[model samples]
Target: MKNYILFFAAIWMTVCFCSCDDGRIYEQKVDIARGGRTLKLTGRFSGLSNWADGYSVVVAGFNDKSEYAVITKSLPVNVADGSEIVMTLGGIGDEVTALKLCVVNRLRECVVDFHTIESEELAAVTDTIMINAGTLDVGMYSTIQSQVFDKKCTMCHGETGSASGNLFLTAGKSYDAMVNQPAHKNSDILLVKPGKAEESFLHLVLNRDGDTNMHHLDLFSEKEQLSLKLIDDWINDGAFLNNK
Candidate 1:
């Protein structure tokens, strides 16, 4: 009986060593998209351990060269058993090719684990579950902006900004070009009102339709739509007048 008891204890320790907080492993992901030239990003994380406090969450993606790499920062999800974190990519510098999520123990050895990500999966994460507060720390921003600029805007305008004919969508230049352009001051007509994304040119292009049913694709999902609201609020909030 003593030998059997010792054997069971040994097995328990082995299992604990290999597993995360819950003695089980899970996968999570992040999603990113654009608002015209601005590299806007938001994503919901799933697969939370029953005890998820202080777990370091990182969103990683591929650079232009198609190499897997970290986005230069770590996103922190505070709370034990915490399964989700909503992040925004602020002031990102370049484009992205692929995405993934890294979950660190934040305990034990403080080691990290990774999972590949996809646009659709990310959309699903946000769609099915809410990302609590929906804000991004600077570390989280790296992944957010990278994904948004690369996945959404890069194909069209090259990076977040840098569009043709004096158009730049890069997050850094997005707000500026839109406000300064005299010829196209109201060209798209999306930034005038806050909280009302429907009136914005971004929606027109994104939804691929207008009062005339222009017949286009509504690329964003329901969750993405909510993210748009957050963005519009920021813009309507005087576009962070500190910059204006």
Candidate 2:
């Protein structure tokens, strides 16, 4: 009897949580009046990056005439927890008897819907968002080195920095070889360009997309250029040792 009871309880719990609103319990509610109707339609949700950053809004009544639909798609600015956002129905002046907001995240794998009660008292939402100030004061080149070492170069490059061809990336000698190395780039390829710096082999190495036997840094590319800027800034700023 006890075993059966436990089994049933588990099933009940699963059914309850398999809903959009409950998927990411991180929900928020914002009270607002829409279209001269004192109703709440949606609440912003926060604390996510692995989810889709877009969603769709829907409103309907008994007849198709009262039905309304719209899509909400926007790029999100990352915050401490996730991205900050505002939720709303896309249409106005439509006789909205019932409203639903469905969200699609970054991966577009998870889809959830929120609903409003009446035409007027529609929005009873949950808004959850975390705001992060956008700032990259860190040096650009060093950041590149850090990324190359931490994410890209480190794997095969090795801690000793001499894993392949004995080129040597070991901390003490890694920077030197990278700065003005000729053998690193192929004959037809000039990875790093000195003086100008931007046209260097390092740039080609990180941004390489052709048949260069090297595994590209697709995952690391988003911030790699910015990191280069930081590195360039550091060199111009006296190349001070920021041994972070």
Candidates in order, TM-scores: namely 0.33, 0.32
Candidate 2 local lDDT, 208-243, one digit each (tens): 555454555564555245444444443444333332
- Evaluated at residue 112, the lDDT of candidate 2 is 29
Clashes (N, CA, C under 3 Å) per candidate: 16, 31
Error of 1 at 16 (Å): 31
lDDT tens per residue, model 1, 60-125: 444455333535335543432234444544323235433544433332121222445444444344
Deviation from native of the Cα of residue 24 in model 1, angstroms:
27
Alpha carbon lDDT of each predicted model: 0.41, 0.40
Q: Which stretches of candidate 2 lie over 4 Å from their true place?
A: 1-148, 160-162, 185-191, 211-213, 219-225, 231-244
- Assess the local accuracy of residue 7 in candidate 1 as a C-alpha lDDT between 0 and 100: 100
